[model samples]
Target chain A: MKRVPLSPLRAILARQLRLLRAERGWSQERLAAEAGLNRTYLSAVERSEQNISIDNLYRIAQALDVSAARLLTDL
Target chain B: MKRVPLSPLRAILARQLRLLRAERGWSQERLAAEAGLNRTYLSAVERSEQNISIDNLYRIAQALDVSAARLLTDL
Candidate 1:
């Protein structure tokens, strides 16, 4: 794996995503299905290895039953 | 110019960006320079024609001296 620099914002997003998913006891596959996203892509996002667009962010937030802004909280 | 469908979240972002820039009396070029992004790319984003990643969003938020979550509000 090519080691890539992690973005601070992405790191925040990763932590928030993981926390949210764990709270609901949903596996990444489960969340991916709910969000209509590929499991691999969702996994990558949780790892902070993907530079996801706002569209994906919105979808994930929606699937997690929250506002997109909620996921972006704490910047 | 091909018309791409606008995303609801992107529309919110565009409106917020424009409002923020206007509040500061900064032109798009000025904000782009402050954000270390291309002027044309910022312009496209303002028009809701860009699929901007979180990295770009972070940069813009930092340039505007606001939290990324602030820009994402009302979504």
Candidate 2:
């Protein structure tokens, strides 16, 4: 089988993170701090330049007070 | 805040892959073929030994005839 990429999932997650953070009126730095992630990494995620791990997704979801599943919805 | 991991997302995606494949009565090999991925990687994903990429998830979801968001829900 041919290789398939996984960046779209990252894009979806990034968009969800951005939306969720904005909904809470928090800056990326604040969200990163809250999610216990590096601000630079968070910025890269928001820009779809990075693929986030499951653990980080959970942390961001938790920091946003939503289920991890919510971040993957409607994308 | 402390560093948070991203394995939970991988776990959730793995579970979703297994559930979706079961619902379709397909083996990991079949799903992997349909998703254009390595059967070994598919097995690893089913066993939670690997983290799937967003592109691969979309392929799997398409192969299973579901939205990518569906894979992330209810976990």
Candidate 3:
């Protein structure tokens, strides 16, 4: 299957999410659990294959103990 | 038809988008054009009826000359 390229914003979000999770030393699975999201979905999100909705971003931000805005700021 | 209640985060985004647009004295149609989104879709987003994707949020932020994080921040 051909892989679709991520939009610049989505790429930024993916990097931000991975960085935040790394800063906390949390595994993707653990963060997914905290965010009430499926682990596979969260992993896909970090891969920039998902155009994650705001509510899901809020969930990840809440799990990371950061503002959703923080995840979005670099864009 | 029954209206769905906005999630708290979505509601905040709606209010923030509207506030920012109002602050710039831009009408919804104008902002939508600037953001390259359909006017009706932008209107629904402003009304908290859309769970806007991160990419679209980025477009709106770019249009408003605000950080995407700024829109997602209140959550």
Candidate 4:
């Protein structure tokens, strides 16, 4: 298989997620429950360890009361 | 495995990709090549059959000469 290149975007997204969650004072568990996601999975996403799907991104954004695109902007 | 809910955003993204490629008059093979992805995989994404990861989304957006967030906006 051809290897995928390293992407700075993932780290950027991870930082954005953590920042957003911190701004709301919500723990990973709270955000995960609100987004109907597993807390562990959400933690992985926040750490940029998961190559997150768009559906999950949408769910997380909804739970955070933000646009899906907003999570990815300015990065 | 736990079930993941269906999300309309995937369909929206698929439609956006198709529309963008059409606007450029590029075939799936062409777009796939430009995005450094397999043609069949890219086709699945266009059909909303794949829950595409953000890294691939970034690659596709780069290949299309648009912002990564642009692909998810106005949907």
Candidate 5:
């Protein structure tokens, strides 16, 4: 299988998500549980190795206690 | 083909995108062109009939002159 390159926007999002999670002092496992997602998948998303679905993003934003817009702002 | 259900967040995004487009007096064709996407695809996205990719969402946000966060805010 061929690997697709990660889009720059996703790179920014991955970085931003990491910062937000760190700011909240939450581990990847904790955040994934709160967001009702698999920890491994969340790890891939944070590493910009996934094309995260919008629904998953929404759930993660809700778990992070921020509006989705705020989560992706400037990214 | 079987249809996938539209997520609530995507429904909100569709409504917001329509409102924003209307406010700007731009047609789907125009927005699609500006966002560098297919008009048909954009139409489906606006109708909440497609699971829009985050990359395309980012492009559309750029064309809308809003942060991706802003676009998904309140959605």
Candidate 6:
């Protein structure tokens, strides 16, 4: 499969997600389970291969106990 | 003018921007200038009418002195 290039926004989001998850010392699987998301989907998002919905973002943010704005501040 | 309905993501972004700005007691104009963005554009983003780029978001986050990950955690 051809790897699609991520847009600047997607790349930023991917980096931010990884950083946030790391800061919390949570593995991807734990974060995904806490956020009520699939591990594979979370992995895809972190890799910038998926376009996630706002609801999903909200769920993830809630799981992380942070505001959505913080997640978006970087783009 | 007909006000277009905001997507869930847009609404979340707008709310977060407003909340963060208020927390710092910075007006839209000051935030815009500090972030190197136009006041009108910042206003539009706060209203959820503008689709901002990742670069712009990074600038805003820098101006606000917050990590990009915090802004995205609530995604």
Highest lDDT: give the candidate number: 4
lDDT of 2: 0.77
Off by over 4 Å in 3: A1-6, B1-6
For every candidate, C-alpha RMSD to the true structure in Å: 5.2, 2.6, 5.5, 2.4, 5.3, 9.3
Clashing pairs in 4: none
Query: Which regions of candidate 2 are displaced past 4 Å?
Result: A2-7, B1-6
The stretch of ten residues in a row with the least summed lDDT in candidate 1 chain B is B1-10
Residue-wise C-alpha lDDT for candidate 4, range A1-75, written one tens digit per residue: 335586556787788899899999999989999898999999988888898988889888888888877888764
On residues A16-59, what C-alpha lDDT tens digit does candidate 1 reach at each position? 99989999999998999888788999998888899999888888
lDDT of each: 0.84, 0.77, 0.81, 0.85, 0.78, 0.70
- B20 in model 4: Cα distance from truth in Å? 1.5
* Candidate 2 per-residue lDDT over residues A1-75, each given as its tens digit: 566655467777777888888888999989989888889998998888876655666787888988877787744
Off by over 4 Å in 1: A1-6, B1-6
Expressed as tens digits, the lDDT of each residue in A1-75 for candidate 6 is 212233455566678788899999999999988887889998988887776655566677777887655565463
Point to the candidate with the largest DockQ: 4
**Could you report the DockQ of all the candidates, in the order they appear?**
0.38, 0.51, 0.36, 0.52, 0.32, 0.11
Report the C-alpha lDDT of model 1 over B1-45, residue by residue, as the tens digit.
222234578888999999999999999989998888889999999
- Tens-place lDDT digits, model 5, residues B1-75: 212244567877788899889989999988988888889988888887877768778788878887666667563
**For residue A27, what is the lDDT in candidate 6?**
99
TM-score of chain A of each: 0.86, 0.88, 0.86, 0.88, 0.85, 0.83
Rank list by DockQ: 4, 2, 1, 3, 5, 6
iRMSD (Å), candidate 2? 3.1
Q: Which prediction has more favorable TM-score, 2 or 3?
A: 3
**Model 2: residue A51 alpha-carbon error in angstroms:** 2.1
**Candidates 4 and 5, the one with greater DockQ:** 4
Please write out the lDDT profile of model 6 over residues B1-75, one tens digit for every residue: 212233455566677778889999999988998887889988988877776655566677777887644554443
What's the TM for model 2?
0.81
Docking class of 1: acceptable
